[model samples]
Target chain A: MTGALAAAAGGGCHIFSGCGFPAPGLQDFIWTPFFTIGQFQFTKPMLLAILSALVVIGFFWAAFRKPKLIPGRTQSLGEMAILAVRDQILRPSLGRKGDSYLPFLVSLFFFIYIMNVMELIPVFQFPVTSRIGFVWPMVFTVYFLYLYLGFMHQGAWGYLRNMIPAGVPWPIYIILVPVELLRFFIFQPFTLGVRLFGNMFAGHLLLTIFTLATWYLLSLSVGLLYAVGSFALAIFVFVLETLVTLLQAFIFTTLTATYIASSVEPAH
Target chain B: MSVRDRSGRDTSVEAESRALGLNIGWTVFSYLLSGMAAYGLIGWLIGRAVRVEILFPVGMLVGLAISLGFVIWRFGKRGITREETSR
Candidate 1:
């Protein structure tokens, strides 16, 4: 669909060429790195991701640096954000026992949220999370943390036993073992990364399609009517995408907390 | 664990529970998909070596059944117990 859209979008330029619509596609996703040092290429997504991390760090620092009994405006906003995540997202999945992980969860939520919010910003229209390159590493770290927690809390063999459950007949063990193994080992992290990437990628594509269509269809005749409709849809889609971005960030953070909760108390 | 909406109009315990239920459903679906893909691939290879086409589908079915059983064990009503459900 994206490829087709890109081809059609390209046709918009020719007008008289009666060509296809020039929409965004897989090619638009592939970026030329701003610079390369050896094998490492610094791309736009990389810059956005780094900026997101810095933004999160800077915000928290400014919010908490004073340690005031009565927080000012910035500090109050920061406290609300932290408290909201704690009560709504983490507390539900993890409870007070998991309070130690609050910092990690807060950081993950804010960083992903900021990266997702970049889509609506004028200069940075592309969402960093839309890039799988940015998502996999974060997911991998969460994966590793959960695994470590599982091993630490459950003991080595205990973790495996907890994962398998018990009382299954020996004959059924063959199928059950592999299913359990693959589900926990691969699917959890894979889905985690893919969920964030897929939401952002699809939302970005939808916005691009509507916006491009509005531009391409803006001729003087009947095209103007179509353009108006397209423009309205574009605005509607853009508004929907903001909610999507926020929801995806929340869901990702919630799931991370859930995974940690399960890992820490595998039997539960 | 209770969180009021931004409007401060209503607590979201019900909504949060629904979200958790949906999260469990998604996890179950992923388990089924991964299980089938894993064993099905193995079965396909064996079937090719043995010149049999039936094992691939057989593998897929077996994988689905195993994952379903796992999901039941992990998420059945009995699995959560009273303590977790209340939370």
Candidate 2:
């Protein structure tokens, strides 16, 4: 029995023939560095980020460059969405003072939405936001704006006091002060980065897993069942990812307005 | 000039002007400084957690939440109606 099994194993019956699946390994899982210029090296994620930005810019440019008075279908839809962000999210949360911050907020909202939507594109089927390098710059931009606004409005002492708030009992100051400090210094930025990262990362991973599963099962005896299941899951996640892409973008922009509003409020 | 009018007008105008300046200044300053710090911290954390520096995008989200909470807490407390009215 052992000899027979050994002979059969050596008979060249590959377990995963014609599966069209990239083998699981570092080469398959790791993204390659595209090239290096001077000290800087560009990778897949970096390329994706650039592509995502260009796609977003191009799409909006085309959509709004030639505005129609009566409105074409695409332009009308685009205009309505931008108007919604301005009216519903920005104005209400930031108030009249929010007008100045509108451009920044709008850019952030659309850029993020496009980057997230990259997961659905055929050849560019990767969400650039899933990469941390791209996210840090964007996150930091907002973080810096917040800090600048806070200090600019209030002097050092005023800013510190502004943080502590008023009306808490004297005893509670001890508890609240540290908590507030932590929230400002640590929590805010962390949440912004993680929330977007987690969602995109999970979405991309799910899509990849289903796609690979579909391929793998298609090579087996009961492959049809796995393929169908994988296809269904992939489609479901694709739709979900689309919603998440937009929702995350909206959340990020809304929070930015809220932060700006908080810093700009008059100090008692 | 009447003492009441002179003192009330001068003090209210001064306070309002100061408040406006402070609001604009603090808003910009806090956003920039905290934004940079948060960005750096999130990048560091993501590199540490995921063993990948490119994972910084994931960290941005974490940083955003933390920083926003801080900014709100720090600034929100300053909105004391009593203090403003008293001034």
Candidate 3:
């Protein structure tokens, strides 16, 4: 009887065989282009990034194409959200003179938000941001902008001075200088990239595992508990992942604004 | 010190002191909690997936290392002054 029950429980394992682990060898998690004429061999992540960009542009274009006098539903909703980020997050952090950087902040916010939301889509289940290649480009973009703006506003020396906090003792400068340098040049972009990458990577992995577990456990009589547990965890994680998708985008945009603001303001 | 100068300095000093405390506390707390939660979750999941104890801590360390790298980089650069320096 015990053996029979175990056999019945193990029956469901066949349903989850293919979906358990990531793909094997070079093809694992990577989508290679079928046709490559020259040196340009497009990968899955790159294609997804491009798609994300187009979707962002398309959404805004459609919503703002025809402006109403009083403002229509979609246009008004979109415009209001954009304006809120501008006024509440960017403006306050950046101050009055920082208005010029609004376009970049807006674009970054929507671009990231759209890419994040891609994970929830039916066919495009994988988020492009989960891949390091896609994340590196975005991180570098922010890094270059911050460096450029800092130099433009304060010049080289001024930008350096902006980094060191005032009122430290002379002897402490030795330790503080190197720490500051490491933070600005190396740490900022690294963290920004890792934060997004880590969150999305972990979230997707959890979803995959739970999904497979759910299927595997449903195969036998004694497996009902496992199936139920897996299902519950999967649903819980899905909701959290959705919230994280939005939160990450917000955090990235806010940090960009803060970085820009720091560049423009005089040292205290 | 004179009374007026002492009072003015005291107010500004108190404000700066408060801000510094708040910033430090907030940063430490936020990173610590998030780090713990992330590592715990990853460790649990990996243990379940592979059915191995080694992978649990290994996964936790990997996650921790990544998060630490980020926090250090983001906050470390704030102290540098980027203005032109005389040769």
Candidate 4:
């Protein structure tokens, strides 16, 4: 997509010029590192990830630095962000008692939402979370916390015992126990990270394809209509990506809260 | 038929159910997948040992069936229990 766009901007490629359509693929995701120190390399996605974290931190710090009897606009915005996560994500899982985890959940939601939203931005058009390497750490954090909370609240043996759902027959336990344990330990966390990565990766690829198609099809003749159609599809995809960016973040945080709640209590 | 709190708001029940609904949705997927994976591996291994190539797919089917049974039992029990309480 980027190559096609650059070519189009340079007035280089058209249908009659014998240039084949450049289809976007996994190559679009692989970035040339900006710099490297020893084995460690920094890339655009890393920069965007750091910028997202800084943005979340700076916005909240600026908004709530001053104590207020009644909230001003910044403070009001900050409260709304907090309250949205709390009411929609946290309370649904942990109830009023989970207010203590509010800060962590709120930060997570914004951090992820911003990273996902980066794909829609002009220059930073890559979603940081599309890189699975960026996603696993967050997954491990949530998984670790879930296990930690389970062990803390329900002790080691009790937590292990809690993996077995209630009221199952004894003979069935032979089959069900292993399934439940594997589901809890492996599948849950695996799906959490992959779900985010898959959505962002697919969304980015779709946008790129339509965009590349738009540029590739643009001509003074019959292809102009096709270019317009491709452009329309790209716009439609962009709108959907915007919604998906937020939805993925919400689902991730909500599932994290759900895991924590199940750990602290017991599986139903 | 919403359950109310001491202050008469039913939001708590609503939120709890929403949470449970989300949990159940994921749990169902996990159950099916885990069952297939677990039994399928066992079936494949045994099949390999006994030189029965059919065991792998057979294992997956068994795993899937067990998972479905468990899901039906667990959620079905909950539905019955809820009906009893509501009555």
Candidate 4 per-residue lDDT, tens place, A179-199, comes to 877788898888889999999
Q: What DockQ, between 0 and 1, does each candidate earn?
A: 0.29, 0.04, 0.04, 0.33
Recovered share of real interface contacts in candidate 4: 0.31
Is candidate 1 or 3 superior in DockQ? 1
In terms of docking quality, how is candidate 3 classified? incorrect
**A14: Cα error in model 3, Å:** 3.3
Could you tell me the TM-score of candidate 2? 0.66
In terms of lDDT, the poorest run of 10 residues in model 3 chain A is: A19-28
Choose the strongest candidate by DockQ: 4
Which digits, one per residue and each the tens of the lDDT, describe model 1 over residues A74-129? 99999999988887777766666778999999999999999999989987788999
Worst 10 residues of 4 chain A by lDDT: A1-10
lDDT of 2 by residue, A44-106 (tens): 667777776787677678779999889887788778777766765566455455677877877
lDDT at B72, model 3: 60
Higher-scoring candidate on lDDT, 1 or 2: 1
- TM-score-better candidate, 3 vs 4: 4
Cα displacement (Å) at residue A186, model 2: 1.6
As a TM-score, model 3 comes out at: 0.70
